[model samples]
Target: MEMNSSNLWVFIETNEKGQAHNVGLELLNPGHSLSRAQGDEVVAIVIGQHTEAAVASAEAYGSDRIIIVEGEEYARYSTDAFAYAFHALITKYAPTSILIGATDLGRDLAPRLACRLKTGLTADCTELDFDEESGNIAWTRPAFGGNLMARILCPNHRPQIGTVRPAVFKKPEQDTSHKAEIVREEIHFSIENIRTKLIEEILDADNETIDLEGAEIIVSGGRGVGGPDGFKVIQQLADALGGTVGASRVAVDSGWISSAHQVGQTGKTVRPRIYIACGISGAIQHLAAMSSSDTIIAINTDPEAPIFKIADYGIVGDLFKVIPEFIALIDEQILTMAV
Candidate 1:
């Protein structure tokens, strides 16, 4: 492994509009920890046109250095162009490792750069640590149907790389007090070398309707809900509490709900203020996603359900019987508060 700079690099993912994604900032926390132990600086790489907001976010999130790659060709995400720029940077600096958010954009970019640089890339890592003894990163992720966790390593590779899932790690509180050295670099590659072109972008119609990632309270239903109609009860309880509805993989697989609402190892990861699991059996895959939630309430008929073990409060009852009562009690409480 030939090395030059020993700094850790984080890819700050941005949309075509140059809006910074939260996962990029979230990664800085682990990056800070790994860098501290590895005796290296944390570098945030902001790519695309008009990246001032991205740069500011990285600095506020505690990056020690900023590398900005801005070009007209980068205004849109053409894999060929972006990959070329990333490869150029890696060759120039030879950073010890690169961390990318496992976002849609990052999922696309990390592998391309890794292939170009001839290095290993781990995807969807839930945890990252610096092995003090081995002087390498231990990237931990769920494996084998989420029955077990696997910690992976790429000892022989320089610029070790991994893509971490969104919300797998908490976002560090922004400290505007922190600052970073800004390095502006130009992507000298020709746009003609790019094989792909961005023609039109059609945004998701349900983007405004769903926000499980930012939802404060989530009421999740699972296999015990019985059928599609079961979700209505879950929704009613969520509405009563001013929360959003979530679903287990079983519910989604049954075609009872949209995949957007699924929360587990295979779905979107979330850490909410309060999580209510109704009828959920709490598989390890499901627990891996929501275990970090501040408060968990499990309502199920089976006392032996795995969810009860981790729940802050467990209710042994049928969800159909329990939810309506909760809605009624909540409504009564609201009326009492108003009075």
Candidate 2:
């Protein structure tokens, strides 16, 4: 493969309806920052049918150029098909670095592409930076069960690859006025080359909703919440704050709440403006998800809870007493504002 130009490449993920995911925009913020610092263009690679909307959305979020691969196989996410398409692009236009979201599809495809190109890939990265002097990328991720941060460097690889967890970075401000060049590429391989067969995809009717990953405010609970009845107080608090309710893994595992509301390394990573951890002990896994929150409030009986370390506000008291009083205060404040 001959390289004509070296730029940063970001893999944009689209939903079933061909709409771009929020994480795709989130990557653009850091991607554009790196591109500006390194004097390289940020090229987004979007694979799917009818991806012009996706491209436009990518451009709105600071993509300098967009490479679109359109085909039926590209519509449905297949690990082999996506890897082949991405590999083809890598061969055609060699990039300085490749970034992908640490979603289910990205987790499956990035490693395969790395293996095919014989390049090093850092997974679940929390931070990325380029060494100006050496022009090498430094990928930072949590290691040893999230106890320590490890910075990885791939000195020999042409395109340093990394996968970042969702919500780890802020979404770039939309620049609709910024124009971007769109490049369309055809999928050379046929259905025969694609070994995997697509079975029927079953989507739950109730599963279609806004996820907490992109939510601005999240009110979460933990084991100190007591039981299912305790969730009422959390719900009231969330309603007062105009935010969604989330739960720690302990709360979910104990049947205090559904797993969908769980926030942790094993659940979902959320970067919100406010993350209130009510009656929750902060485990390393739990911290992995909401540590990126702008403001964290920890309200628990134990003053020594680990969550207080990262919390912007630490309230040492029973949540049962704290929540109602907090809600009343907020209500009164709202009423005063109305006056």
Candidate No. with top lDDT: 1
* Maximum-TM-score candidate: 2
Model 1 poorest ten-residue lDDT run: 199-208
lDDT of 2 by residue, 1-339 (tens): 233377999999998888888778889988988888888889999998678778889999888889999998777788878898999999889898999999888899999999999999999999888777777788999987689999889989878899999999988888899888888888655767778887777764534553788677899999999999999999899989989899999998998877778898888899899999999999998998899899999998998899999999989999999999999999999999999
Q: What's the CA RMSD for each of the models?
A: 2.8, 2.0
For each candidate in turn, the TM-score is 0.91, 0.95
Task: State candidate 1's TM-score.
Answer: 0.91
lDDT of 1 by residue, 205-256 (tens): 6665878878899999999998899999999999988899999999999999
lDDT of each: 0.89, 0.88
